[model samples]
Target: MPTKDHYAAITTTLLVWGLSGALFGALFVGLYQVSWSLGLPGWQTLLVATMIAAMTTSAFYSAMPVALVGTMAGVLASISYLIAFGLKAELITIAGVAGVAGVAAGSLYAWMVTRGSRPLAEILNGLIAGLLAGGLLVLAFALTGWQVNMFVLAAVAVACVGTLFQLSDGWLVDRVAHWLPAMLSAPVVAGVIAAVVGASIWFIGGTTTALLDDRMTAALEEILSSIPSGLLGGFVGGALSGLLLEFLGFRLEAGR
Candidate 1:
């Protein structure tokens, strides 16, 4: 029952976000190279870029109107990174990989939102999934003997929560009467959650490192820090693009 306008909005939003994500992904690759060349921790640079992408995408997605908003946001944000930082063939490969992942993640999230499920169920599912993934990553680091950085982990955690919100907002908005207020408060909640998760990961990683001389911990930490940021960025970017499309009188639910 969606209208023509809605379809248009969704299409435009997806187009914009996809392009942006590819650009960002390239940029991130470049940044990673630069950081590595400069003797900076590759993970730290990646973490910063991811944070930027997440915040930008989240802000845009929350206020925007469109289906597949989260996916678009991810794509666009990734594109931005590519444009700014990408270089060699390997970097290009990474960008492509990220793009595919973004598409898959975005599609799944969009489907969930459109289905209008219970907010609590969605949130719980997201959180559980994230935690399981994160924990596994931590364990992987322990096996490899790596070091963990708290700041990067914190940023990643925040980004993850933000991404979850972006994908589940429709259900959340309808379930909670004070949805707008909650949306407005999301960043703060995300920040706190990120801090807690980050701290917990850091503590666990550190303890494991002390008990076991695994240097792979650092690599795990880096991965954890970056993934959330990338996801967050995509969410925010898609949201913004969707909003812009909506403002132009395009709806993603027209003719229903």
Candidate 2:
């Protein structure tokens, strides 16, 4: 049976990540709005905001320097892609490039965070996690076509990627006995957790009114409209991630 300490840790993780998600979600909307106002493409703005929010959320969760570097790397890659391809790039092309960039960002973050220990396994975990995270971000953007709330979409994606990124570090990367194949298995587990949490956030955010448009044409007044969605989605995702991690045999380190 789980102890009170476990429950407390779960509660803590949920609160911390939820607040973090809300904070980052707001930042995402602001950044996206600014970029959109400057006439950037919807996909381009989404990439910029998503990468920044995801990296910042990662840093908040892990309290690591690699998150800073990861943020820079991801942002630069997004900007570079925009400069090279312009607005004419197809969604499939964007997805492929984003996947590649995510792999690089994840590998770099894993290498730096682990300091070259079990490099292959850690890098593998990063690659898989990053790819999925990147692809899902685009999916979230696409969901906007179906009228999904942008704030919820961003919160769900960022919260999912951020939690999984650090969870793998603690559960698999930090352990020596976890082999290459076993390490590679982390993404499958993380993906399932993310899917559940993402869906919950979607439901929570979807039922409400979307204040701001996620696209470049949204008016300035709508920028702050998604704050509520961000907060709620972040809280739900963080709480569920904590509960799931605890059940999976990982200790939730408070304030870390």
Candidate 3:
């Protein structure tokens, strides 16, 4: 039977992650619009946007370590974006790059949230989680192209990497306790959960975008329409996943 705490976790995760996704979608599209309108370089715009999001992560938790960790995460993410633009990479390539960057950012997030405790363990586990999360994103991009939007994928991937890294010692330890230590188990669990959640969101958002595109007038318009599609998918998928994860005994720690 579901307890009151379970219901609360479900409600909270749904609202928080859903809003987070919508915000990410808006920021992503908004940056593109700014780049187009101002004739600004895409790399420059991406850098600015990534920095803002990175800093916002620490700020969101009101953590004291925001300065160092946020700056590092922002720089890492921005560099990936710059590289992607320079290479004129396809969506799959971009997704892979985003996963690598997400791992670094997530590690930083864990460090901050835990107030610098267990540095080596957190980073190593985060790396393993990254491989899983990154591969999943690559697969998702290959399947859906731009229908789901990169922002939503990256947001969920990065956030999960951090949260899952934190959880490696809890339930995951039991599942892999026979073969692996707590640190190793964290990544496996985190990666799997992230993949499932990310893929589900991709399917939902991509499907919605496809349906919407069928009624649209032009290529550019159809592309632009994905923003709302991402928003809807993020909310619905986030809510559903939150419920499932909570029921399965997954929990996120509040910012310290």
What does candidate 3's lDDT look like per residue over 1-256, in tens digits? 8689866766675677556545434433433443444466544544443333322321332222423343344345445554545434333443344444445554545544543323223334444544454455446556776543554543554444334434563434334434434332222222222222222233323423434334432433544555575455435544555455555666642332
Winner by TM-score between candidate 3 and candidate 1: 3
TM-score of each: 0.30, 0.50, 0.36
Ranking by lDDT: 2, 3, 1
Model 2, runs deviating above 4 Å: 64-132, 139-145, 171-219
lDDT of 2 by residue, 1-256 (tens): 8699866767776677667667566656655665677689867776766555554454434433433443444445545655675544433444345445544655545544453334334444444444466567667658765445765665566556655666677566567434444432322222222222222232223322243245522444455565566656656665666566666766666436
Q: Return the top candidate by TM-score.
A: 2
C-alpha local distance difference test of each model:
0.41, 0.52, 0.42
Please count the clashing residue pairs in each candidate, in the order shown: 67, 0, 0
Kindly list the per-residue Cα lDDT of model 1 for residues 181-244, writing each as its tens digit.
3322322223322322222233323333433334455644554455445444434544454455
